[model samples]
Target: MTVETIDLDAAGVRALNRRLQGRDGPVAGGHFIVTNAKGRHALAVGLTEAMDVRIRGHVGYYCAGMNREADVTVEGNAGTGVAENLMSGTVRVTGDTSQSAGASGRGGLLVIEGSASARCGITMKGIDIVVGGSIGHMSAFMAQAGRLVVCGDAGAYLGDSIYEAEIFVRGRVESLGADCVEKDMGERAADGLQTLLERAGVAADAREFRRYGSARQLYNFRVDNAAAY
Candidate 1:
């Protein structure tokens, strides 16, 4: 496949984005490699095609945000809100990510090969995130749907104030949040967990992981549950 290289240092971010979005010229949808990212924010944000993009270096805030039907891979570390609000397709980070990674994403998959900072996957609506390393404090807070898989330890208050989101941790969890509680992983659930691991190319035994979800006690504001809230 032919690869087009875009230099972020010279073309400027707007020109690069316009070319990727196929706005000022040929319609997008091809393989592209971005060079000299230099920790730029919003690299490849709001992509709405089926193109493939690979960023060769570290990226700053909100890289690949609001993505749809595209495959984006960051060859280096990512800053805050990586792949946030992803609508479809895949966004992968081969290195660590900053806070709020994949926040409020509605669909698709996010694979993080390294650890993530605070509030990873917060408020995720339907996205599936697989982290090869640990996640920081308050990860998955208020997540409404989808799943979060942490291959390493999870920091304090995992899934705090969560809502109907499935969480699986292969390592120790510092603490469970308000409505988050561990539950028995049935046969079907274990099978699904295996599938996620396979999709993320993570090698781990599904039986070794623990599953957690909302206890459903805080769904309504009852007077007795007021203190918990």
Candidate 2:
């Protein structure tokens, strides 16, 4: 493996990426480790190959955007939109993540070791998001289809405007969103959350979680209930 240690600077990181992009063959699949970094944003963006990128410190907004098949890991807290529009593979944050962590993601797995801010999985399509800590309000908002597992407290207005997505919360929820309600924790959900928690390395029982999801009330608009709008 060709190891490259990059400093946590915008220009230095950009130059490294440019150099990596120009490389051919197995060089693209080697390990790219970042050290002594601090709150840098968009550290790895638009990388198409399957590589392992490890960031040793805190990261700012959009740490990995439009990733195709790379596995990126962050050792510290991350800002908003940590893995936006991910296509495949996994992006794991070993610390807390901010709002819109996996917004509009299409595929892959996003594991957060700590709490996530509001809209944790907004508009998510097929990604499986597992949060070891609590999540903020409006989580799973307009989520078309995906699985979101929250091991801690969930904020208000959870799963608002959701569509065909499964949400499992292990802690108290302030409120449920429109067209969203709690369902009986079936064996499928239980098994699913167990797998997710195991993958995220969260030490929690899946049975302890309470499930919440769409009630299918607002799938279509109704003029008679316009007052509720």
For each predicted model, how many residue pairs clash, with residues at least 3 apart or on different chains?
0, 1
- Which residue pairs does candidate 2 place in steric collision? 179-215
* Full-model lDDT, candidate 1: 0.93
Report the lDDT of model 2 for residue 166: 88
lDDT of 2 at 14: 76
lDDT for model 2, please. Answer: 0.84
For lDDT, the strongest prediction is: 1
Each model's RMSD to truth, in Å? 2.7, 3.5
Model 1 alpha-carbon miss at residue 7, Å: 0.4
For model 2, residues 1-229, the per-residue Cα lDDT tens digits are: 5777766664466765564453534545768888766787777776678888888999889988777788889999999998998877789999999999989989888999889999999999988899989999999999888889988899999999888888998889999888888999999889988887887778889999988777777836456676776
- Residue 117 of model 1, lDDT score: 93
Report the C-alpha lDDT of model 1 over 106-174, residue by residue, as the tens digit.
999999999999999999999999999999999999999999999999999999888888999999999
Model 2 error, position 94 (Å): 1.5
